[model samples]
Target chain A: MKKIKTANYDICFGIEGYAVLGQYLNEKKYSKIIILTDSNCNEHCLPHFLSNLPTHILFEIIEIEPGEEFKNLEIFTGILQTMTELEADRKSVMITVGGGVVSDLGGFVASVYMRGIDCINIPTTLLAMVDASVGGKTGVDLEGIKNCVGTFSMPRMVIVDTSYLETLNGRQIRAGYAEMLKHGLIYDAAYYDYLKDISNIDFEDLSLLIFHSVYIKNEIVSQDPEESGLRKILNFGHTVGHAIESYFLTQNNKNPLLHGEAVAVGMVIEAYISTQLSSFSKDDYEDIKKTIHNIYEKVQIQADDIEQILSWIKFDKKNYNGNIYSVLLSNKGKAEYDFLISKDLVIRGFKEYLK
Target chain B: MKKIKTANYDICFGIEGYAVLGQYLNEKKYSKIIILTDSNCNEHCLPHFLSNLPTHILFEIIEIEPGEEFKNLEIFTGILQTMTELEADRKSVMITVGGGVVSDLGGFVASVYMRGIDCINIPTTLLAMVDASVGGKTGVDLEGIKNCVGTFSMPRMVIVDTSYLETLNGRQIRAGYAEMLKHGLIYDAAYYDYLKDISNIDFEDLSLLIFHSVYIKNEIVSQDPEESGLRKILNFGHTVGHAIESYFLTQNNKNPLLHGEAVAVGMVIEAYISTQLSSFSKDDYEDIKKTIHNIYEKVQIQADDIEQILSWIKFDKKNYNGNIYSVLLSNKGKAEYDFLISKDLVIRGFKEYLK
Candidate 1:
């Protein structure tokens, strides 16, 4: 059992380690077992999952459609209703077994249902294994606002099994790898250089990357669980990233951006902003830009699109008192938050991206 | 300042003490201020409240029509939307006024909006002042289920000013007092005796009763903030009481029972169950019944109402599996939870209430 201890809980990796789920369930003595998953994972991964678990432990499976579209309150409310119908009490354990959407929505449901119940995260996607599953951040999107309503509540445990990654398509893997790159870019320059050779990495070595990403995030969150200070560094690309994601999600005729894909672009733009305003070296900024451009195709932000994105950013939960705040890299591995970036500077950053 | 400190936070009492809201705001330096109130409080109390605050300190007020009916997700969504439109951020402070509905709904909004903002509760009704405002239990009722969708997130502070009670009608006062009496019945025998001669108590001295009730609740919550053990005692009457409350609230023909009124009846029925099964002395049970009957006007639960209420109890968040569980009194000032009772005995308990 390969186990990593976080400040509050443990993240167990591999089949043998996560198999302790049965042992945990027995010890806790939950009244019932519930598994929340998306349709994709349910068909592709749940069977493999159930086989690995201890036999004779009856559990209910709740499946929703796979996509960011399902990460809304309407779907969330439906799930809560089903849990109520099943008579799921506080003693029941809800295990989320899908990607970011399942982990985010299921975690939010567990945090709020009956003033919160125990939740276990079984991330079936690389993106979730590295990012969403580890952090205590749980939420559902409200009215085109990304994570507008949420809470910081840790899961009982997070199971990181790389075998589930076999079910994912190529784009899904790249989408998840984007967040893994982010972990290195914002925290460890050496790791960032190592991640640049991701194309040459083998599946057997992927678990190490997942562990490293989760460790960085856990260390950040352990210092600031409520996100009052140091944790904002974790949102390195997310301020602009979330706005871009929302723009695509809410608008018609726009191609939807995967969370990590959006953040990849967001990091490039924010890196440019950092070069102009903060002490970030221009050489380092170009390195970040080149690396991101190599992996993610360019997302054109037209003048009209820029206006809408700025509007979305203005209403971002991070900004306060009508001032726009962004977490920008001071250098390749260090970041600073609460930086009051002016609209002109933000527009300039986007214009620079266009060039 | 009459400040009662709980495990996580403090409850400040009196006009002068709670008036420090201005100072607190100044020291904390919130970006903006928003007050959540009901129509009744808006008309009767907002002006007085605004006057008490520091001049030049502006705040936005959002008012909903007062009632338990508005304590649902739809209204909760609307409130979240309004906060987003107003661009309320993590640095903003939300002060909730009115009764249980306002406190519960507002606290929930604050808890989830941008993953939580600072919440200061200025409880306007007696029920909220004593029970709803103190505990971190923030939520909304879901699809006829009471507090099924909620979270245990404490407010930044709770301000108890009895002057708000002057606006409440007599029924509302008694509704709040029911919880106060419950505090005594479960933990303090002397206070229970003090609650018995309610009619003779001076209104000017109401503050003392309010303080005592809050103290008892805070002590219980401090020990078991999550309600897995010692905190279950607070649910002594609430198991049956909540079902009865939900039954009336969901049915069109049945007049909705105020929380404390439903609780008063729940105590009588539960007293009988305790005497029969949990070693509660017959003499104490009779004393409890007599005291409750004298204070609260009888709410007749017809034989027809039993089946539905029973169903409600079975589905309560507190119970698990096929068995119905409740916190039953062992004696006055003592109680036990996870008491598994059969349906036949529950029906007999209701019959005993009717007698």
Candidate 2:
């Protein structure tokens, strides 16, 4: 619970991260300690954090509005200007205290300021704790291009304190569970079995589960930090998942689907694709479809939605030179990456998903 | 000469870079080859480079306007859009075929596109050949903040073809020499002695000198790629030099001083500061002053310019909290970094330069 050392830095659990943060500040004696947070975290998580921090170093807060629209070059420039005004030199340590949006943009700010500076992540959501805070990928969107500019830079350490989950409603925490489900599906059948049919997720049990989920992600990232080969497996649900997420985001009538919900749907359909194209068991595909439907409300991908969804799927970043490449399941608890899938199979999967 | 091995990649000499590039293209068989340049390089250096490339690989060009005004996030985003349209995938190699502005922006494009792709620099300018091409410092200016967004990424190789220097004027080449003089002032006194009193620089000899200049920079850069300490010596003239450059940049009454002109003036003033604050020989400072004055037209810094220049100096990126740090001379050919010089000494150095 103290610290789990990975390829680049340690991932500290709960209050142990605070203890380590105190030690780190005392030893490094950075020119300044800057806290990068959003207005949401500043209101919700900051008080608990500041009271618990066992350090004498007075820190400064750089708070941005809590949303993705604010994550761009203009905001990036504003942060730099603030840092310049604060005289935050290369010796400054920027501790990001919020969810993925905060860390994604702030981590990038830390990485590029003066060609790079040190950063520590304090993930405040279940989703961020399990996924965004574990990996080194940090970037900001450009001209509406998502993560168009980024660098793979690890933080000095990651602090995942599950107590922050108390601030979130059920839907928010469940959105994080989607990534944990993907982690288990790809690596450990035993882990997947525990969560596959959960009638209720106990908060205390979920903390231990989040720890295991991060450990899985950290292990994969350590082996392939830059996503050359092994790391592509992590994109299993994201290819179709992101497309579905984008589709719903554009529609004004439908409520915005939580990322975990869209990804859950992606997993079911992709699991179907795996059985048809790869060595995945047909029975496993059928089981996934039923369980995912039972867990989350089914979104109708009607005949009209089919073509638009297919277009979105083909636009995956992994696609190259007119070929669509994907991470599909070869078997339960194992994932195969960079598999080229045809458009017909995708349409057929959507047809199957609809049925 | 074929190649000079640096810490990360080779600094290919003349046509040898093209030959190595041919072999690299065949060996790597990248997803695609993208040529990033400006209208200036596309018009001037592209044809000669194309004929000598010795490769069968059909490459596409991503050209932009040819000036610093065009080097910003809008341009950076446009290039990304063009690359996306071209299907320039992760395996694509972006060969920057121009001077610093092109390379600074293009190199950054290559480094960040798909979270970083392969980049090869083909520097067409003399200043870029010996300095920018040798070090992997690629970035874009943001909202008047110079190099506010960048990454310390090395190229696969640098193509330093001297034939491109034919397109430059005499002032352009001499501008490059100011940096060469700096290399000798910091790391090699013997190198300085060779160029100090040269009344006329033969083009043939200049090429050889440029090779040595790049070699010196690469040596210092390799030892400290991220500028922890040793690499700061490379900024010997740059601290005060940048201030002078910024000052003149604002004045519409005067023609823009070439970058080398500002740095030459900086080297003289800082050399004077060195003699006062450090163990530098006064005779060496006097020799540098007289020789530099003879080489470049001395730009007068009247009493009015002093306060503005002083303001710019304190704004040095190396300055932390409120202290001004610089790379000052400890001796001839020996530079000491992170030297804290008092304001009085800096003012005295300027007074000496004016005298």
Q: Indicate which candidate wins on DockQ.
A: 1
TM-score of each: 0.98, 0.95
- Alpha carbon lDDT at B302, candidate 2: 85
| Minimal lDDT window, size 10, model 1 chain B | B49-58
What are the runs in model 1 whose C-alpha is more than 4 Å off? Answer: none
Model 1 pairs in collision: none
lDDT of 1 by residue, B304-328 (tens): 8988898888667778776788889
RMSD of each predicted structure:
1.4, 2.1
Best by lDDT: 1
Worst 10 residues of 2 chain A by lDDT: A140-149
TM-score of A-chain in each prediction? 0.97, 0.93
How well does model 2 score by local distance difference test?
0.82
Calculate the i-RMS of every candidate, to one decimal place.
1.0, 2.4
**C-alpha DockQ for predicted model 1:** 0.82
| Share of true Cα-Cα contacts across chains kept by each model | 0.86, 0.47
Model 1's CAPRI class is high
